[model samples]
Target: MRAAEIRLPGVAPVVVDREVPRAGDGEVVVEVVAAPVTPLDVLCAGGKSYFGVPRTPYVPGVQGVGTVDGRLVWFPTSAGMEPGDGSMAGAAVARRSDLVELPDGVDPVLVAAAGLSAVAAHMAMTWRGELVAGEQVVVLGAGGVVGQAAVQLARLAGARRVVAAARSAEARTRAAAAGADAVVALDTSDHMELVGRFLAACDGAADLVLDPLFGVPAAAAAHTLRAGGRMVTLGASAGRTCPLDAAVLYGRSLRLLGYTNKELTGAQQGEAVGVVAGAVARGELVVAHEVVELGEVTGAWERQEAGVVRGRVVLVP
Candidate 1:
């Protein structure tokens, strides 16, 4: 079998030949159909992510869609960022509890491409963020895969208004297409100015904020949340170390919540995946993504790391 092996932390993966994974007693070996290269995978391989790196000489994908003895499933690589191998290979091992069976005939690439990014968006809004129907929701970093998914998921989750914030013109356009009622064009720098711009776009106040971009973006979004509104931080793509205004936090009685798939029980995770997958299978939610051969994992990593590639990028092994 072939895999994108990471022999050194903080370096890119190299395509290498390796033995196929074998199913353990309570695990299933998924014949890799498609896997998405995510920021988590990159951060983990860098040995700097919260979960840290594996012992090395391991595969690096975090989630994927594949089949176990021909039954299609979506599974997470429990070994990713901790130890052992991941889904960035021709075959990967997954605990049975990690597998979520898919509806019949859905596209594996589409499901795989959604991966953890989309799941975070869906769960952050509906579960963690508790976004109420007819409420206003804001998605920071709306140009990225998670942001795009968040925008659409907010609508599907019954948010009456969805506001998307991003720095790129392309992202703004993409956000609108994804079902945002309004799109706030963000500035990469200028924290205060960015805050002002975001506040102005809100018209009044927002009910929930799905924030992936921390730093200035999170702080800015925090101020726009309506009294008692919650802002869920699922990631820190823009940068960590957000500066919260003491006045804003206390004045509005705002709540800042941290979120991750790890917080969910296995059953909760399955339910969450099922909801998102149902919407996806029904075409109620979609995001733009590019497909690449798994053989080109290094180049794909570079492109994804550069942050220039718009939409989800899937690798077919």
Candidate 2:
């Protein structure tokens, strides 16, 4: 079997020949099809994440779309989070409990690209944020995979207006393409200026916020929320600590919530993946992504880590 091996921490994986993995009692062997180079994979492989340094000389993929007993499925792997090889190979070993059967006609590469990122967007907005129809939504970091998915999922959930904010012109364009009602640039450091831009774009206060970028953007978006509005944050690409105003929270009685995929049970994760796959099958949800062969893993991994890719990078093995 051929796989991409992370021989060293904080470095790209190299293609190497390895013995095909054997399934254990509770595990199954999946013929890998498509694997995504997610931020979590990069974080874990960096040896700097809270999960701590991972064992080296291992495959580096957190999730992938593959076939188990000839049935198409989406599965997650411990990978860099634990001492094990992942889905970035011709075959991967995954617990049967972790497999989610994908819907018919859904593109494996697309599903792999969206994967947990889309699940986070969907769950954060509906389950954690309690988003309702006819509500206004503001999505921060609207160009990334999670942001792109959140923008469309909000609309699919019947949001009356969806405002998107991103740090780059390209990101803003991608947000617009994802059906955002209005797009705001996070170019300025002036918090009040950003709040003004968001307010102007939203027409009025937003009822919900899908915030992936913390720090300044999250703080600014907080001011755009309506009284009692909810902000569900799932990532901190902008910054770990936000400069949110205490007044904004108390004065408006706003709800600040956090979300993570790990908080969901196997059933919840499976259901969310099914929903996302259904959306993709219906062509109602699409995120920008680039596909490359498994042999190109190094370049794709480097590009993803450097934020040079416009969207998620899927490696087809």
Which candidate ranks first by TM-score, i.e. highest? 2
TM-scores of all candidate predictions against the true structure: 0.94, 0.98
Candidate 1, residues 1-317, lDDT tens digits: the string is: 98999888878889999998888899989999998888778778887767765688889888888898789999988555677888989999999987999988888888877767788898888888888788888899898889988998888878877889988899888888988888887866777887888787785789999998888888888878888999999888778798889999999899999998888888888887887788789987788889999889899988887777778789999
Candidate 1 has a TM-score of: 0.94
lDDT of 2: 0.93
lDDT of 2 by residue, 159-244 (tens): 99999999999999999999999999999989999988988898788999898989999999999888999999998888999999
- What is the Cα-based lDDT of residue 20 in candidate 2? 97
Instruction: Evaluate residue 20 in candidate 1 and report its C-alpha lDDT on the 0 to 100 scale.
Output: 88
Weakest 10 consecutive residues, lDDT, candidate 1?
76-85
Model 2 misses residue 75 by how many Å? 0.4
**Candidate lDDT values, in order:** 0.85, 0.93
- In model 2, which runs have C-alpha deviations exceeding 4 angstroms? none
Error of 2 at 71 (Å): 1.3
List pairs with backbone clashes in candidate 2.
none
Sliding window of 10 residues with minimal summed lDDT for model 2? 196-205
